[model samples]
Target chain A: MRKWSWMTILVAVMLLVSACGSNSSGSQHNKQQSNGGNSGSEAEKQDVTLSFIHWRGEDVEVLDGIIAKFEQEYPYIHVETQVFPSDQYQSTAQAKIADGSVGDVFTVFPGAQFQAIARAGLFTDLTGESFVEHFEPNLIAAGQQDGKQFALPYQLVYNIPIYNVALFEQHQVEVPLDWDSFLAALEVFKQAGLTPIAFPGADIGPGQLMNSMVMNNAPDEDIFVKLEAGEAKLTDEWWVKTLAQFKELNDKGYLQKDAVGAKQDSSIALFVQEQAAILGTGSFHLASNKASNPNLKQGLLAPITVSADEAVYEGIHTTTFMLAVNSKSKHTEEAKLFIEFLSRSDIAAEYANGTGQNVTVKDVEYTSEELQIVSEWTTKHTRFQPRFTISNGEVQKAVTNSIQAVLSGVSAEQAAAEAQAIVEQQIGQ
Target chain B: MKKHLRLLPFILPGLVLYAVLFMYPTISALYYSFTNWDGLSPSYQYVGLQNYVKVSEDIIFRKSLGNNVKFMLTVVLIQTVVSLLLALQIYKKSKLNVFLRALYFLPTILSSVSVGFIWTFIYDSNLGALNKLLQIIGLESLAQNWLGNPGIAIFSIAAVQAWAHIGQMAVLFVAGLQSIPAEIKEAAILDGASQTGLFFRITWPLLAPAAAIVVSYTTIQSFKAFDLVFTMTGGGPNYATEILSTYIYSSAFLNYAFGKAATASVYFLLLIAVITFLQFKLLRTDRVSY
Candidate 1:
């Protein structure tokens, strides 16, 4: 009987321990409240901490500076920033949002993913906010679904071919302006024992590469819109040709043998190390590439024409990243204030200068020479990438997978058809 | 009744925790499996049998299921045989045995993420140590893309999983071997039974219980393999290495198809349950006694 009583006591202690363990958050909240009590009026006035989450862990230093500025501007509001890797961000963010534990302000990818979350009422609609007026109208439209803006672009990125000028000079391969010349240059580089292109054919890389090629032969600006409207399909003649050409690069062994396995970092390393002549990337890599190989001359070029007959390269422009406020946030006002501060022209300029990324703010000038070239491209012949017009990330992912499948021995036609099937299936739904 | 009441408190806490944390989510998943819930949507409609029907028709899901089956069978066979061999080699009491046991178990302590990163470098096509070593050994022709080739990427990943987990199985086997009385083995030796003959006739038969535990564990583990696959190939090279777990994750989070993901998970659980039960039944042997 005494042993039984001891067992009961043991059980009670465990129960108490677990009960206390589960309420640790509650205890912390209470502690915060007690701390607030010490400050009195100042705490009562505006002591609120807002959680800000984004996916770019590599940009933590840049974000830290921006966050510091945000905190200084709004002393009463404390901003806690969390970063997740790009690969895991979507899944992690989705889980957090579903459980109502997401950051007060979170980053969302544009297009179908943004639309899906926004349509589900997961993002606070910033439709008529005054700060929205300062953004480029096109950028604002990118985050809108049926006239309700749920997000705003903070960074503008231009996807083009970033070439190693030294490699080009070493191999005596001219920068190609059209499809034929591109193939010719690739042959020259291959002959010179250099990888023609460092293409990370995994995840979103293949899709971006395909997008770079398709833009060369894009029938018109409305092609993506038509595809979204079900008037055009991935199996269309232009897309099939574009996909074939994309796979041709693989078939010709212009891309490294294991580009399908290598990720962005490894593939980019090839370019930075001068082992590869070209990288299909954006202005984001300019600073890092220059820093890593300071003596290597580098330049960015717009997507080459798909045909020798084409007169000009169709430059591609898209919002790189966007900031959104969680609809279920307890500190909604504070989250919005953080977003507003982050979107300010001066702040955006600072971010642009800090990260060497192009700003999406309506008339902000950047000092980065790489961004200056991107600005010129945007002014000239820029077209919205498929992500901006077609809103389904899964469909885009399917397309990326299909393109990669071609490298794994799947026929170009089959890959294109498969990608089209995904779009069709989504439409059927 | 009063005496039982005293035990109630002891059981109640554990029961409530299990109910809330494990059973509740399981029941919720079962319920969600029947609905067209995107997980983030505030409300969802119960779409009877729709997600299951989609799963049946989905080629990627079928491929993922096949990959998981392949991974399970391969890992179970390889890990079990290798670990049993190691357990036999090091079952004797010796200082060298202790050191080798610890050395073999080192990889099991490392996180799946670290293992994935390490193996990825070893298999890298260009600068990977594996290819470089192959070149150094003048076996360059035999060098292949371990993770890139869709035909063998699943096998490559399975091999890494087996390598990491073989130590645990080896330890389990050693315990089982140690449990068999020395008198039985001495009796067999007295009968002039050779070592291999003794192992086959006695030791193998007695290791059934341990084999059951190991096979069941490995099967469930192989079915639930996600972290290594996620960290390494990301179900890529056209999803050649995608297993059911990674597929379910992608479906739920990436595609925002929670209902489909949940349905697949339920199916996965049922499949694993049936397989594990069959495994225990098949591996069940008459208890060996002196």
Candidate 2:
């Protein structure tokens, strides 16, 4: 009985100590925030910790080098970087923001995902920031919502699919400059018994493909925005044509048999193995592909879906990796400083060369011939990826599903009608 | 009261953990199911069954439910039978039997995501080993796009789920098999009972508890087979492999409709409960006595 009583007493004592420890720890935390190391010794002075979160696991090495440079320049601030896989980043970021533990600086996807975070009132407006002037206006406009620069675009990517220039040269096939020429090029590849385009029909592949497919097909860039507001419908000829483009690819044996099951990795492998002539992805994959197969010469193919005269946009481009300071951040000025440092011409050039990406910051030169080839689009008539303009994921899924449905043997008309019905339901909601 | 008080200190941590982690989320999910929360934002309106009404009308939800039922039935039937048969074949204590059982159980120790990736390579339409092997054997007609075909995608995953868990269920059956009274089996054999007759009359009857356990566990396992489906196919080739858990996740994460996801979760909870209850009743048997 005495032992039991003592054990109970010990348990009570533990609970009391735990409660008291928690209270004092919380108070000490508040005190630390209030002082911010001002009253402490020189070693403790202005030692601010800034959390920077991004989803590019592949860019971690390059980003780490950049962050190290940033820290050396700004010794008073310690930046913690959190990198998540791109697959789960959107949901994870949203959850972090909701739980009030979001990064001091975080990345936002252009258009829909940006609109979502901006709508949540989490973005610290960057319109007045001096770094905002570093980016080209047309490309950086993607990060703006309702005329406010909520985020600043960094990575300037051409959404046009990357094709094998070596394959084209070997087969005496020219780079297709128009719809008719594109069909002729496909015929050349098919006749040679190679897949004209390696199509990854699953996951984000179909959606990414839509950007290039619909570039010249849509009458205007506001078509997706209009669909959201009920001013336009997905059943419109432009949208149907986009779905039909994929159907035509399938029907013509340009893609592999049962291409509907293929994934991005598999298709990329096929391209690297020379089983396919064109990889149906973007410039974002250039660095990885070069690393995978050095002999593989790459070129961009935007697939002009209309006559040269009717084409308004020559290709698709997106300014993504939109960096924004969180509205709830404690070290907003410090976070902004990091973003500003990245905007410096020399630093931006380094990032561009390191990542093999086209940074939106002006005067950043590309050393990679592949990137140099794609960099010409920075001066061309490039349309922003239209699919990103749809702020609703379900609506975006519906539009992308239309293409998938057509690939799976559904008629373009029926797929368009089904997609339009979903649009109507969404607009009604 | 004194006895209970003495136990309080030991139970308190576990009790608090259960309440905080499980009970709190469950209750909160129930509350959110009644609202129009977008998952991330704190602000939301009380919609009062609007989400339920919408999910009922949702075609994808119906399709996913149908897929889940098919997945569950296939996994439960296949896993239960295969594991039980393996248990019967190697239930006796021997060095060879022990090695075989360990080999069978090895896959269970692997993480589902790792297993999903390995199996994904095996199931790939063009580059997969399964198709390659089939073609090499001159059985080209038997080659399939395992994870791609809408008709067989769910079943392909179901087969994986069974294969991944069959060892654990077999181990459980081994214990049950060992527990059967030796005298009863001896008597059945001495009475001129054939091998088949002896198994039906004695061994199977004694294995009721294990079968009940295996069936119940398998039924529940099929419903929560998320990572395998997610990493393998992501419920695609146009939702051919979409099940309840994936559907709910898509509603919350993909669509950002937390209210709809919560409602679906409630439906899923009720579904598992009803199925598990029916399973128990159908497999009910009296506790054996000597």
Candidate 3:
């Protein structure tokens, strides 16, 4: 009984010590702030730190600059940025948000993920915010749930096929304007012992490729919207044909035969090294490629169409990353201030220049040549292109898997049927 | 009442932490499993058994369940047998044996994500060490896409899981072997027992407790497989390597079906519980009072 009493006393003392330790540290922080307050004029108040979480490790330096500028402008508000690896970010962010420990502002995708969180009122609805007025209407709609805007886009990503200019010139391969011409050019590249396109079969590469193909060939704009609404099915002829086209490239050996095992970075490396003629990637990669190999010339072609009959749908233009203020955050006002500061055209231009991407602000100019080309492509082919919306993620996964299945000796019909079943099951649930 | 009060103070912090961190979540998961909660929604309908029914008919979930069972069985058998064999070989305290033991255990200390990346590079068709080694040995035809083939991807991943963990099991077995009284082995040897006979009759029986630990630990770890599968294939090459954890993750985070994910977790918990219980029963050994 004496030993038990001593143990209980020790535990209580340890707990008290820890509690005191925390209290002192917190008071120390307060003391430093108060000292600053004492030194500064009456106008300067205590510091308010807002936590901003995002997944872009590459953009850390750029974000730091932006944060520094924002801090200078709003002296009392400081933004502490937290970043996670892209692959783990979604799950980590979701877990944090679910646990009610999300940062003041965090990056969110525009589709199902954004919608799921937005619908649950996790994000403070920015529907009436003045900063929301600066973004494109289509982009605002992309991040909308019902009638309320919950996300604010900062950058635009254009998903055109970036190509090696030297390789295409070396092979005398003309840029293919239609599906048959694309195949012909690919066959030419294959004959020259070059990989036509370095497709990463192991990741979202297949899905992106299929989306580009389907969008290029799509007869109407509402395919994805219909699928999301359950008014359509994955077994639709267009989707099957899209997978078949992807498989046809695999069959023809234009896609690296071993691509099914190769990752996105590895496949992109092939293109960057000029081992492949074309790379189906976004315009965002141009600056990085130039930095890595300055001598290697790169260019973009309009996304391929299905023969001469269908109009080319250019490429999927969507928000690169969007910011959403956590509804549960204690510092919502500061978060809003930071978001609005980012929406300024000068800051948007600086970000675009730093990141080598296009911004969503109305007056922000395309800072890079790559952005200009993307702008040209989208401008020329606006009529046929679908408005930027998040595709049904389940359907997208099904199509990607179907492409892999076709390459793995499953018949196109069988693969399509299996994918259809999976999508239908997803819809049914 | 005083006796209970004294004990309660000693355990209070741990009990509070456990209740807050573990018990609360587990109980909440149980409650959420019966609802139509999307993990984010403030409002959810009570849809009892619907998520489970959906899971029962979900082909991908069924496939994932089968794959997980295969993963668990393969990992348990391969890890246990391989570890036992290696432990026997290196149980002695020679410098070489200690070095080999440490060398084998090196992988166990590496994060699963790092191991997955290392193995992924090793299995790469064009640049991988495995394929290059085959090329060097004039067995070029034998070099196949180890991770790309749907038929073998899961097994390949399982093999990696075993490789990464078998070392820890071997170390555990070694500890078990060392704990066995030296006199027992000497007595068997003095009786003119064959080495194999002594091992089977004496050494093996004594190693049961350790074997039970290894088998049980590996079994649970295998069922909870996530990082390796997530990094290696993301349960890809056409859902060939989909396991319950990855499926549940996709359902919850990717597909936004949190109710289904919660139900899957409950099922997973029950499965692991039953399997571990069965393993404990089957591997139960008489206490050696040496």
Candidate 4:
């Protein structure tokens, strides 16, 4: 009987330990909360591990350089980093957040993804930090909620098409500043046996193209954002016109044949091989395109949908790749320190030059030829890429799908009606 | 009793792992299905069948479900016929057959992601080998955007899905073909049964177990394949390729509606279950013996 009782006791003890082990994250969260009270040299004496997670595998090399510098400066704090593929990162990061195993710092997209995570109280408040003020105020708006800065937008991009200047010059075609010339240029390129604008109707290309498509058509800037607020409808003239442009482009055979099936990489390849006159992806892809074809000459182009005189905006520009510290992170202080370190003008310049991305850090030198080419457009009147304004991914998907349907031979009005139906459903919900 | 007690430690580890790893999460997912959980937050509003009702009414869900059925039918019908044909040609033992078997089975060994990328390049309208081959043969008029066209995109991917696993299914059929005793085949030949008659009466009926396995497996794999669709198209050209698995992923991760995703998942599981069960019943799981 005693032997049996001893065995039962051992089993019970093991079960309890396993159960307790499962609750380690909860205890860790408590420890993080407790650690918030300590500061200065006392905190520095103990080594703290800060996990930084992001979805940009392309920028890993540049990020590693930044991380290495930060570690060198702040030896007491060791930063661990992980980069998830863009497609799978969101769900995986959400799972990590739920389990309290997410990084102390993480990168989030500007609008819908950030809003979703922020609503769940995932981001540490950065409003009090002085570094928040150093970033251009407008660029940082994506990360602010309820008058508080929840994150900092890092990447400044032209979210429009990047044209091959050499192709245009070789064809004796000047840059088209308005709708008529844009179409004319496309015809010229078509006659020259080149794909006019390499439109990726599939994947994220359609959504990103929305910024430039509606840039000059809208009554004001941030029209897509206003559409989400019920101030505008998808059936409105501007949106219908946007859809028509896609249709007209497709009908004229300016966008590559079977553009609807083309993904981002294929479209970029078309542009790189000089078979396509323009790549619809802009500054985000400049470095990669330059790498793929070193001799390739690229220039930014966002067509004024209206006549040049009527156009209010030169192009679309937006800050993306918002960085935030986890609210529940055990190493929040150290994570914030790393973020602050990255925000320094010199550090941001190093990042921008190395990655061929323009950061929101105040007044950084542009040494990369691609950056120098796009530098002037940064000073021009450009609207924030309006696609990021819709905080609902489904509604956003519908909006892009409408454009794709038009590209695939649907009438603009019909596409708008279908999209409007979805927008109405979203509003009702 | 002492011996059984000694074995408890080994069993306990596996039992605990199964409970914690599999059972706990599955049960938690079920719980989340009934509530409006966004997957990020711990607390959620329990809305009973509200998530279910919403999913049924969603246009995207209906479209995706329709796509899923079309994809499943394509994959199953094509994969079944091709694999069985391959198995019949090579079921007999030979050195050449051994080499041919591996050649046929080559695709199944590669990861779906790699296969998807390879196929994507092959299907490219301009630079892709498929289109170039068509043009080379002066069949340029027949060349189409394999993935870009909304109408045929799903089928294009389904063909690849079938291609990926046709070898695997062929191997299953090969095993089933090899299992039948040679004496039975010899007896049938002596009975003056026509080749066609022998196939329908003996070979096919005897091959039921393997056909059942192939059909059921193909159906399941077709319905659940995510990486292939994601890598090739990411359910695009305007949701034309959006099947249930991709739809569920978009719902949870893209839409940030985990409750709706979970609700969709329940229906998705039921759909695959009902399909496979119907297949099993049609094939009659009771083996036809020699």
Candidate 5:
């Protein structure tokens, strides 16, 4: 009986130790709350591991260069990179943010989703940082909401109409500047037995291109601001006129025959294959187009000349990608340092020239003539529309889907009506 | 009492784990479902029945629930019938039968994520193998966007689900088929019955237990269909292929509406429970004496 009691005590002690071990570790972790930039007293040169997440398959080498420089400068911190596929990026990032397990820094598109994240205080405020000062005002404006800065422009992209110069030269046609001339150019290409404009009407990106055209041609940016504030409806005369314009493009034979079945990449490939004479894409396509057809002559960036007056064309700045630090990060200072390093003019130049990205930094030197032209155009005349900055993901998706429906035979009026209803539902009006 | 006390030490760990990991979280989730929480804010309000009210009016939620029910019914009925038929044909002990059974079960081993992607490529409108084959066979007019057309996308996704799980069901049915004594089959053969009659009368009657298991499993899985719909249609072309799991995911992650997502999950749990209960009740069989 005494031996039995001794055995029981031994088992009890073992169990208690195990339970206490697990509970203590969990409590210790839970005790370390995410209070931004509050550095606890630890070894000054303590070994720290930081995780950075982004989606950049084409510019991975440039990213590696930036990471190397950061590590060389901050020897105490080791950075690990996790690249998620583009399709799953938004949901995956959201999941990480919800679970309080987001990486120190992550990539975010400049729009309503980013705004919501910033509004919820999910990203560190980078307003006073030197890197924020270095960015162009429009680029900085894209990442700002409620007068607070939450992200920095690490890479910049501008949506422009890129035509196959070789095809244009072959057909003896000049690129069109205004909507009327653009339609006429399409007629010329169609007569020559070539697809005039490859529109990925089936996908959301093509619909976005249509939206961009409408936004660019708006009387002023105030219309978009009004729309965001619920003071204006898409069913108004301006939107009706815009829908008419899109319908006009569709009626003309300039658009691809099966635009509803085309994808953005496939549409771009059509231009590369010389099947289509024109493709509208961001400046990121330079590397891909060159790779697809090495001997293809470079195309011109036909500014979306919506109005005869150059004033309307001069002030349209589309949204670009931005880098945001997770507000819940324990290492906010280190994350800020990384963002600052990447935003430096010299570093931006290295990234831009090496990866063929048209960056937004004023001091970055462009190696390619195409990038140089886009940068110059952006600097000379561009304004970030507030529509792109509203924090409403559902509304954006609804508008995108409406575009797809319209391109697939749903009347533009019907699509606009449905899109207006969805926006109203989202804002609970 | 002392002997039982010794067992307490052995059982204590598992009991604690279950209470902490399973019971606590489930109960908490149920409680949270009645609140209005945006997941990140430090505070939330207890708005009883408001989330449920919103769910009732939500068009996507209703559509997804309907799709889940449709999937459950089709997968449960068709998969059981097809798998049982295949099992009956290959019940004999032949090398070819074994090889074919193994070949049929290959899809069950691949991950559902990979299978979803493979089927997406197969259903691609422009560059898919299916469309290309249709064109080759002069059936070009029949080629449609299988995953994009809202009318047929759900059924197309259901067909893939059936293909992926039919093999496992077949193996289960085979085991049930073999468990029946050979003398029963022999008696049916001598009763002047045709092969088809023999199966419908004797073999299928004996396979009720296996059918119950397969129906229950497949119904649960179909209700939880997420990856395939997520990868293929993304519940798109106007929410045609949406399911409860994806709806819950979008609500929780995209909208950050945690309380609503938790409410959606409770609905899912209730759905699975009711379906399982009905299946067991409807398919209940009395033991047969030889």
Candidate 6:
């Protein structure tokens, strides 16, 4: 009797262990099946939550309005938005990507950065989609890599020379159209006891502005393209001339004395306060100026007086902010739908008018005067200069540093040569 | 054997975490440094010392290393002196001492990002308080672009970093000072030793362990300095403030050169290891008995 009872207990213990194992395995398998089933069903379902990440603090109100409209129309599919501080965006986004916690949709800039992310397969490809056709051809080109589209350019930016119209009119300084005329205007402004131009050499974006101004008049885009391709050296005559011009401006005391140290906001403040006569920036600055100082009368000039007689207003369409879908997102379709909706001309128009974004949608009507100026510039200038898009980040740093060097009394020729060397070293050319 | 078996559970969790988090990545990083991996792509081709060779040839990397050394020296020497002085002053029991200690340590408690932003405004050429104060005090000529000039930019950034951490160091020093027996100080006073002589002979000698700890912490912190330089100048004004960590970050994320970044990390780790080893060896003095 005792042996039979002990045998029964042993069997019971074995059965319990086996039951637990099978139960856990069964649940895991069930989970996999349900996940697959849900993904399949998600395609047909309209109700979903899509998260979007951006770093545009200044345009938060306009973005919120756009989100509200989106939510209103697609009630079942709610859109959640998160904005990161601009300075920490890259690091934060990189960390999120590493941890597999990035939002369903995120913003990506064009150039080598976009290429790097795309190469990593972090973003979903949206090529050959009807939504891509709606973007401007130049913007489409900016977002493409090896025949695949990884990002959609939301805005077409034109690096135009913006001047204080009231300051110019008050000082009786005619708007310059070419390099010589621009230099002549600088002298006149300097002689009149006014700072001629304010450039933020301390920040990289402003430094690139100086380079873009010279590149606008290059005999051919080949100079820059060759440099990018490692075929051209920085010691080229065109680069030398470009650097020399930068030095001349600095040597003549035309630029702000503390230009090298000036922050972008500080530089903008000077231009808005009419402390400086000219500032080189995108047409988007028009709206920014109005927002910051409603009283300041600002005028836009196309690519600061380039030497090109035929393409006098040659400008580069920098890859402005763009929205990309995370490849690893469970709700990729929903995210893609959100991107498509955001890219539509009508929706873009609402955002542009509401937020003063210089969006690139061709069919969008301009409601704001600032946007109208950008539209006018785009229509007039068909030929566009390609901004520093495909260069390595080190190359960008080198170029920015070279510009800083020029502002600090280093000869432009020397700075350009050093920049060329740095680029070559970075690309292993 | 039973005792060893019982001890296993206590150390297992820490061992597992360290192996997974630190050891695995470290070993992988060392292995990846030999390849041409960009942190993506399924396969990587072995480059075999190319990254190391490139590090030697890269001028920017060399400049970054030099800058890091300079930052460490400045932060350690200046911060140590300032902190020691402040700690000495705040070692007393008066209410004023507590108030002053709290005030000094306030900056350290704030995030480096906030401190950087505040300092940026304070150093702004046109709108900054520093220039305004200079103008008000008739020292306008001395006020130049504090963070804009390459010659003074790195040191200016270092000053901010030092100011931010001085309080923490001072507090640590104060604790060390207080830990010293009061009877010893009284005995020195009774022996007719001057305050300065007593400080040099008794207090400073006994405080060697604290000083060593402070130096090691400051050195490590200075070596990895990123946020302030990133926020303030972004290693700008002709790479004046570029440090090793920022350079490695730009190489890895910005340039997508993961192999080079890993190599940089390896170098940095080796450097820190050597410094730490030497510090302990040199600073491990005879312990003071109460």
* Candidate 5 per-residue lDDT over residues A1-429, each given as its tens digit: 786688657655555455435434643443455552346124346766677887776778788988898899989877888888765666566556533455788877776557556655677788888878777776666777678887776666655556777887787777565766767778888988988877665454443464356655565666655665799887777676666666666677667754654557667777888888877555567677877888766554443536555425443456465788776677667777788888788998888888878776768888875676567666455555434644565566565666556555567788778778767766667
Q: What is the TM-score of chain B alone in each candidate?
A: 0.96, 0.96, 0.95, 0.94, 0.92, 0.94
Please provide the root mean square deviation of candidate 4 (C-alpha atoms, Å): 4.2
Query: Sorted on DockQ, highest at the top, how do the candidates line up?
Result: 4, 2, 6, 1, 3, 5
Native interface contacts kept by each candidate, as a fraction: 0.42, 0.34, 0.50, 0.51, 0.10, 0.48
lDDT tens digits, residues B1-290, model 2? 68977988999899678655765566667777988777655356889988888887776788789999999999999898899899999999999999999999999999999999999889888888999999999999999878877789899999999999999999999999999989888988889999999888788877888888889888888998999999998887666788899988877887778889999999888899998888777766556455
Candidate 4 per-residue lDDT, tens place, A1-429, comes to 688778757755555565434435554654566355234234764798887888988789988998899989988888888989886786677667544355778888887888888877788789989888679987888899999899899989888799998998999999888899999999999998889989877776788788888877884766766777778888999999989988898899998888887878889888999999988877888888999999999889887788989988888888888899887776667778889999999999999998898888887888999888767786788888888888888889889999888888889999998888887766553
lDDT of 4 by residue, B1-290 (tens): 78877988988889678766865555556667888877666456889998888889888889999999899999999999999999999999999999999999999999999999999999987678999999999999989989988899999999999999998999999999999888888899999989999899888999999999999999899999898999998887788898889989988998788889988988887888898899999998686867
Write down the lDDT of every candidate, Cα atoms only: 0.78, 0.83, 0.78, 0.84, 0.72, 0.76
Cα-lDDT of candidate 2: 0.83
lDDT of 5 by residue, B1-290 (tens): 68968888898899668656765556556666888776555456888998888776776688889888887777777888899889988878899999989988999999998998898768767667888899999999999878666677788889899999999999999998999899988987888889889878887778878888888999998899898888766676656677999889877766667788889888788878998898888876556445
**Model 2: per-residue lDDT, tens digit, A338-358?**
899999989998888988888
- Tens digit of per-residue lDDT, candidate 6, span A1-429: 576567547645554455335434644553453344226234655577777887887778887888788778777777887888865665456446532345778887666567677776666788877788778877666667788887887866666667888888887878676777778888888888877887777874454475456555454655655777887766777566666777777788988888888888887888888788877566667787888888877766643535547444455556567778776566777777788788888889988888777787768998877777777766564344344553567876776688788877788778887788778878787
**Candidate 4 accuracy as TM-score:** 0.92
How much does candidate 5 score in TM-score? 0.86
How high is the lDDT of residue B44 in model 3?
Answer: 70
Residue runs of model 1 more than 4 Å from their true location after superposition: A1-45, A97-102, A170-172, A220-231, A308-313, A387-390, A420-429, B285-290
Question: Which candidate should be chosen as best, given lDDT against the real structure?
Answer: 4
Cα miss at A398, model 3 (Å)?
2.6
Whose DockQ is greatest here? 4
lDDT (C-alpha) at residue B156 in model 3: 90
Where does the lowest 10-residue lDDT sum fall in candidate 4 chain B? B22-31
Query: On a 0 to 100 scale, what is the lDDT of residue A318 in model 5?
Result: 61
RMSD in angstroms between candidate 2 and the native structure over all alpha carbons = 5.1
Rate residue A287 of model 6 by lDDT: 85
Which should have the higher TM-score, number 2 or number 6? 2
Clashes of 1: 1
TM-score of chain A of each: 0.82, 0.89, 0.84, 0.89, 0.86, 0.84
lDDT of model 6 at position A108: 70
lDDT of 1 at A346: 86
State which docking tier applies to candidate 1.
acceptable
